[model samples]
Target: MAADTAEENGDAASCSTATLSKDLADLPQDVFLLIITYLSARDSVACRSISRAWHAAFTSEDASLLLLRWHFSRSRETRALVSGWDSRSPGTGRESIAAVFAKVARRYHHLRQAKPRLIEKIDVVQEATHRDLHRGVAPWDRILRWNDNKAIFQYSDPTWCMDDGLLIYPGLDGGQYVAYDLETQRRFHVPFDNADKTVRRVRLACGVLVIEWCERAPYHQLNEREVVHRTFATAYDVQRAQSRSSSSRSAKLAIVRSPSDDSSAWTIVFRSEWKIHFLGLPLNATDRFFSTHNGTHYALYIWQPHRSPWGDDDPIEQLAVWNISFPSAYRPSLDPAGTKRPDADLGPSVIQRLTWRELEIIGLRQRHTPAIRELAMDENNLYVHEEEHRWLAGTQSSIFPPRHHTVRCTGFPLVGIGPIWYDECCADGDVHMSFCPRSGSTAGLSFADADAEAEAEAAGNRAPTPLPLTSYRKSTWPGYAPCWRHEEFPYLTVSDMKDALAGVRVVARQCFMVEALSVFVMPRISIEADEDADADTENPEARFADEMWTELMGKGRIYGDERWVVGEDAEGRITIVRF
Candidate 1:
């Protein structure tokens, strides 16, 4: 009995000494609680295994540790949501958006069932993501304010363009142009020496900025009286900071100009040929240039609308290839074949040049087709807008097809070419176009006697023409929800074009009037491990692996859709939607 009592006394002494020895007893209980409150739910749960005090503090409802833990969990969840997109490249903790949403949904489901009041905050965040699967609210619940007023042109109207994660426009104080990177959050400004020059046009492609302007010559000088139009294209080197360790702020980009230019720090990649014309129309009317590679792949598009209504002699669409040479400083990671080879040749120097290869448009367009409404191009495919015609013979006025809001892509018939054509185009010297299958009255109906006689008799002397199977390619979005509205032509952003060329497959169907932004999460199809390994046999799955197949992800915007929609509200505050 005496031994047992002694042992009990010794145990009590050890507990006292251990608690006081670490100076833990000197700290206030509230301070300890506050420290643990900042930890994530996973870490807080782990603390419960540490000591009795930590367990007690975490369990207390009045301390609100449960609420803090939940907040931290949701913050982690939001990051997961952003990173859950189908980037194809691995090493992101999660795979697809659907997986991340499912995991988060299950977590909140359990939390709501356990503690109703504690989950109110999580519910608000959930509502933002889940509110409208069809109608996307502004990116995040808040508006992105552009604090730099110097970049604005007219207080009422702003002229800016966002493409491939870049925002470019002339600064509010004319002659100054600003290019902001969406991914890196880097800002770059280029100032024109002469403020008198009028900025005519601005375009951003493959990380290169091209500005075209009319130089205002002094009226006193007779020889230089005409406004000379010129184009200046520059490539910027955005060096990301090494300390990506900071949690709150993204990496700051430092724009470094090449050593070669006298007018500005930026490296001059290309200069437009000087042209003097009395009339507005010039021979070199190159309106737009499409490039997916930083230094490799390029295509120049020359717009030619119909001149004569009845003639079909001249081809309406003409596409040509261009070889863009980039200096070593402007090495783009996305190769012509869509595979991202970051270590690919940056080029020999910071100076770049573009050489054009002329080609005739053939085997693409049919005769008597309507005029092209809009044109979109990437490294892999070209999206051309055409009118939709729906002809129903039985109904009056239905014999003619519908003539509005129809668009088709050029690389559809080819199976896996849409995603990986960049690499293939660079490999071979051939460019291919997709063909649309014919459908209508005579389609699928054989005129061989028996059925033809019955159909003609049933139709009362006039046989109905069979409808053609000319439906828009629905396979682009395989698993999209039927409820979501569909748009014939959703405005394709520069980022969208870059991503498509880089092999990030998406079934992009813009919802009609509602402007529904539906981002499909395509899961990487898994291959069976137990398949027979015959070295001679070809892998069937490999052929279709890169094909664009969209899996139905719950209605939400995919991560990289961070382009801003800028506008002015009633209070004169610039309203921006950062989606």
Candidate 2:
């Protein structure tokens, strides 16, 4: 009898708990919304899809949800919307209210006025402006096609036309590097030889021209070791060198240019060798140099070997940032004993490495490896095209399988590794560019409401009009202060042909192939950050992920236009694609 009474009490307690859970699940709509409003936009959308009741309960009737509804209505494709949304963190719950309103307003403005159009489709024709090369025929075609057969003027590499109106070419033999100035009508030849090692590739950014020389070690028939590739780099100040002479392209030893001063002539910024074992495939590394408000940064994207748990060498790709203004202490000669220098001044230069493990919540266990195509940085942003590959099949074997690549444009905060925004497109590459209007190109503040205020002021109705409380107006409101010194003109206008000329547009010509790429800044973009932006001393990859929200005030905000010009071989045509 005592045992039966105890069992009855236990069953009664279990029944009560079950009844309480059901009652809570059946809570009234008003009370449930109070709890749901705190959830993230993504989670809120997910919760609303759980059941018919949930779908009915969650509506855009809530004023705070108005912006979210606008975004969804514009982009019904959930995947695209989510992909763009993931680029930045929408603060939890009510904190995102103001941000959402700002986004909606921006979207309205973009749709209303910034309707991009293709103004002109001019063909890139190479006319025979110079008579020496060919008396009658257009020599551009023949000269560009010159190869080993035409030994006197052999040139196989495609000409790289930079935005600064300069052309760079890698000669066929004997460390012969050529630079031609279109403005001065001068040509320069520099014999950049390194113990007979060939320059495999080159990249130019800011005023620094980085030359990559690579040589393979001799092979031994009986050896089972992997192939060893030795690589080295030498940076030159090309801008100063260009301004040095207007007559002839003379062969010079070194141009002493400083990163702090563009007026300084080309300088040898020291040389460093790269030692790494390569797999059977050829080693492919791409690098870029860009100047931010704080300092010049170089990003080297290379495939490196990572040891797996099973002691096997797995390829790990990395994008490393270095300060080009300072010499690297990590060079082999700096520390011959291979000891770590804890007190070394890595400085604001080549100092940080942003890894996927540090950026993603999944950490290093991610299955796909991202193939970085290129690195682009502006005064307030760093952008990269990250291509993630996935195997077609799941197998336990050691052999590699066929894979597919998905390209994504990832934007990082100006100061850290945390992503500020992300966008997915069905394109092969991604790049970012910004432009400030030429003086008096458009009406004052053509892209802002301040233009109306200026007109009101001119009419003598200066009632000290109050600024809009929206984030867009507050960012540039008169007397409004920022944590950093903002640019005098930070936005772009593309409504008219003049605005198009003031900015840039990119179009795709299905025929041409892209041979060379570059970006240029008129006058020059400032590399000085604000006092507050300079206060964060943490490594880019070590900062708290939450800093992404605080650092990225406006997501999907870009200035000017990014255009790519691709050169074609047969027709000598070029295609420009704008981003």
Candidate 3:
């Protein structure tokens, strides 16, 4: 707890200002409840002077506690006090948002006497990091909130649709898809095509529910090639809930002009099934994927691995994009080799879905190396913002470090890469320079300390109880969320990047860090364990034990459709990436 004192010399400005007007003169309990819920604690404190009745009501244990949470969020001593209260009925603990405000106000009253000085902490490091426009104290969230826009957007899960623009998230347990218009205060719920809770999975169509589970995808070949498999489920306008499973595998697709009770009003449209073709194998990594949909065709671009897959440490020497398209399912030209397939007549015909317009910005690449951080498209010069540690800037060269960079696009002879992936160009570009975010260890202190002395004297209202030392638990996570972090990008560079590169240049270079986990997901137990070992050979599961054990020695286990890409570059340096 922080020591505070609010003697007779306290100023009125430090108190709260929650007030009620003539409209709320009567000030019903419910109305005051609303005031406590919405008004800031500073504002609420001033309301206490309104009347004796108001003072008694706001000072109640419930009201004060709520106010405490609203002010300080969490107080270890308060929590401890609350925990000791009798579980059967509320105890005499009076800590809440109201309590925190009162306590804090008292501290400000005393601090007015002593000079509270502001200090700037300078971090003098020999390495370069991301741009630090504002002092370290500036809000970091502003980076994501560019243009003063909200960084986080809340909405229903994006997938299904029953109307035009708005889509409904499917219910987990046979729930209807509800559409809500916050503007007009209108809401609508769409019923499921079938009532069977068993057949719950669905694929959203233009504006209807296409009940089905995700199609099975083919596993990568031993060589780790790109495999594209077509969907197998047939489409339909409406599907009657059939009691049987095997027979109902097909979908209905007929349209009923007028409403009727007949289930046959819907007819089956067509079955879907795609073919297999390899993309960049584990060796040739895909850099980026972009695609566009034209009226009758679609074009894609795939930024792909540029060099011969031979070593582990080699970087992409250049950038390249491929050209491909998807026309109607009736087009034979859409085949992987442009050869006629059984369903070629239903496929798309043309390639290159994007025109020169929609994809205005494309040519951002660093000189054969340079780890990329942020990329945004704009007109004029495509920016290639970069951040390299100051240490790496001079004597040593870094393969990766706490750096950020940008690139721009100019006119070039380009083409679409593949379906769903855009590789508009096939060339390497020059090197560029820019900076990234700082490597400072950031921490957010969430729990607050109560101003003990001032709190005990504030408003002359006694604390009723004393506080204890040692309040809250320690923090577990120190860095950014792994998911939010560009896992491949580096954060700290106390050492030079060039030094790191040279040090880890050999095969199997690994790095690890502490990650605060809200929930720890255990590694799958399904790893093929020991079967009866052929005593002469090895533990059936132990055939490759040493290799797997070596990888697991220090690496954090990551799963969920996990596959590792180990691409050997020309220099024989191998880069192992797992996604």
Candidate achieving the largest TM-score: 2
**Clash count for each candidate, listed in order shown:** 23, 14, 85
496-552 in candidate 1: lDDT tens per residue?
Answer: 111211112122222112222222211111111112333222211111111111111
Candidate 3 per-residue C-alpha lDDT over 1-579 given as tens digits, one digit per residue, 9 for 90 to 100? 122334322433334233323434357766666566555455567777788877777766556655554333223223333344212111122234444456544432222221112211111111012111101111111121223332221111112322221223333333444443211223344443322221212333332333322112333443344442221111223222122111121111111011122221222232232221133222111333322221222223333334456744333333222211222333221344545564444443232233223433342343333433322222211112223322133112354533232221233333434222122111111122112232111111111233553355365542223223232221112112111122122322111001110011111212123122111101111011113322123111101112322332221221111112122222212223221
At residue 143, candidate 3 shows an lDDT of 20
User: Model 1 — TM-score against the truth?
Assistant: 0.36
Q: Model 2, which residues run further than 4 Å from truth?
A: 1-163, 173-175, 218-225, 241-295, 304-314, 327-350, 354-356, 359-371, 379-381, 387-407, 413-420, 424-501, 504-506, 511-579
Worst lDDT window (10 residues) for model 2? 520-529
Better of 2 and 3 by lDDT: 2
For residues 213-264, could you state the per-residue lDDT of candidate 2 as single tens digits?
4444432222243343344455555543332221211211011111222222
Q: Kindly report the root-mean-square deviation of model 1 from the true structure over all alpha carbons.
A: 21.1
Scored by CA lDDT, what does every candidate get?
0.29, 0.33, 0.28
Q: Which regions in candidate 3 have their CA more than 4 angstroms from the true location?
A: 1-337, 341-363, 373-579
Instruction: Tell me the spans in candidate 1 whose CA falls farther than 4 Å from its real position.
Output: 1-158, 163-166, 181-186, 191-201, 212-294, 305-317, 327-361, 364-406, 411-575
